[model samples]
Target: MLIKVCLNGGRLRRDHPAVPLTPAELAADAAACVAVGAGAVHMHPRDADGNETLAPTEIAAAVAAVRAACPGTPVGVSTGVWISDGDPDARWHTVSTWGSLPAADRPDFASVNVGEPGFTALAELLLELGVAVEPGVWSTDDAEHLAESGVAARCLRILVEIIGVPADLAPSLAERILTRLDDLGVEGERLLHGEEAATWPMVEMAARLGLATRIGLEDTVSGPGGVNVPNNSALVRLAARMGA
Candidate 1:
């Protein structure tokens, strides 16, 4: 199974001391996670203030640094609307600037949430920019939306991201979304993951289903036993032990 390490999401230093917020820090964390069995990297590039940003410079620096640290390991970034204050147009503009980045500095792929406004346009732009699009499907509705949009077939993979659900219920929720995608003929590689309380359960579920899964401070701050995890590498190590 492919276990991608999400170095950070919108997390701050207050959330975890080890959350990598700088280009060098992200590089170090990516190297450590890859050493511990993480096969790929997903991260949210942050500005100097530690807030997520879609700025081309920040994105280029983050992607370049991580790729340097873990050569040949795929590196991906988030295009979540929250980074653009929920303004799809602003997000589009920032992402459009990524085309100016040199090929080596650009992300290998980027996650674009299907539920967000202008998701289709964002995905199209990323495709045109020579970046693979990973469609993030948060619910059955998003799965149906992805299927209807005809973009699922072009995505690097579908991210079955289960968030805001209880751990016990998350696996079943993920199942429903997966079933919906399957029924709609949305077939390809699928990566399953969850946030907060649902993280570990979904990780185990993904392993059981033989699907790709991800882990890191982006998904949770704790290990499978609910203990506070020290860093992204620790989470990847534990997930690796679980056969992720």
Candidate 2:
């Protein structure tokens, strides 16, 4: 199973002392997680002011650093709509700038949320740049959107991401999303994951179902049994122990 360590999302230094924001910090944290058995890495590249950015320079810096730290591990970044404040046109413009970056400095793959505006166009752009696209399906509706959008078959994988739900309900919600995808004949590799309160349950569920799952400060700051985690490596270690 592929256990990707999400280094950080829109998290800030106040969210966790070890929340990696700078390129060097992301590189160090990614190396640590990879050393502990994380098969891949996903992170939101941050600007100098500690905010998520889709700028090519910032993305290149983060991707290149992580690649140097963990030579063969796959590195992915978020093309979240919020980075551009929901302006699809601006997001596309900024991402288009990435074409100027050397291949080595580009993300191996990028997570494009299907529910976001202009997601298909963005995914198409990523493909044009030779980057694999991992479509993020946060709900059954998102799954349906992905199916209807005609990009499911071409994607590197489908991210069945469940968020804003209670732990007790996560697995069933995930099942519903999976079932929806299956019913729609959305054939492709799928990575199941949940955020915040639902993180570990989804991890265990993913392990039980033999699917890829991810964990890190971006998903939760607490470990199983609600213990506070010290860093991304610690979360990866615990997930590894759980057979993720």
Candidate 3:
């Protein structure tokens, strides 16, 4: 179990204006997150346009900065279909672009959302490239499909996301994930995260289950105390408190 933080999600600039987009700002946030005990860090590489891109240069630059800032921390990037100008084979292009990146600046891992067209291909590509894979399961069928698809057997870790849902239902989502893991008869690294207010409960449940967790503006625009968090480290530190 490893606690990670997602630095930026989407449109967070105005919601929590302190969210970092520049490489220097991202570097500072990574350093602070690692200092506070988060073992892994996640982020989307956004250019000056504030749109996520999977281009080799964008991924390379951001990865280099974060690695330099937090030498030993595992760096993972988002490979979501939501990325702007995402290709019909976007997963292939985006992930292969990451795979071909320089070793020193290459991402340690990258997330592949389940229940999508390019899901299995991205998983295989990541495995073949030797980049750790973190598969995010947002629904019961996603977990079931992964189990049957045989990707789960090779996944480096699992990140169960219950986005846009209520907090009270999160524990149930956690329960189902555990059950799905059992049903599949496969167990590996796992973490819980969600969108907005329910994000807190998901983290709490992660702590209670002694499993890994993630927090950041990507998941919630508001701070833990409902004040806007200046940076991702603020959310990481708060998640640490739950486990502390």
Q: Count the backbone clashes (under 3 Å) in each candidate.
A: 0, 0, 0
Candidate 2, residues 1-244: lDDT per residue as tens digits? Answer: 7899999998887888889999999999999999998999999999888889999999999999999999999999999999999899999999999999999999999999999999999999999998999999999999999999987899998999998999999988999999999999999888999999899999888888889999999999989989988999999999988883
Off by over 4 Å in 1: none
Q: Write the per-residue lDDT of candidate 1 for residues 67-89, one digit (tens) a residue.
A: 99999999999999989999999
Ranking by lDDT: 2, 1, 3
Point out where model 2 deviates above 4 Å: none
lDDT of 3 at 107: 83
lDDT of 3 by residue, 1-244 (tens): 4689888866456677878887787888888988987898898988768778778788888989999999888998888877835453865865677666668877888898886677888788878877778898988888887787788878878888987777778778778977887787767878887788689888888888888888887888765557766667777878889988
TM-score of each: 0.98, 0.98, 0.93
Reference-based TM-score, model 1: 0.98
Pairs of residues at least 3 apart in sequence or in different chains that clash in candidate 3: none
Overall local distance difference test of candidate 3: 0.81
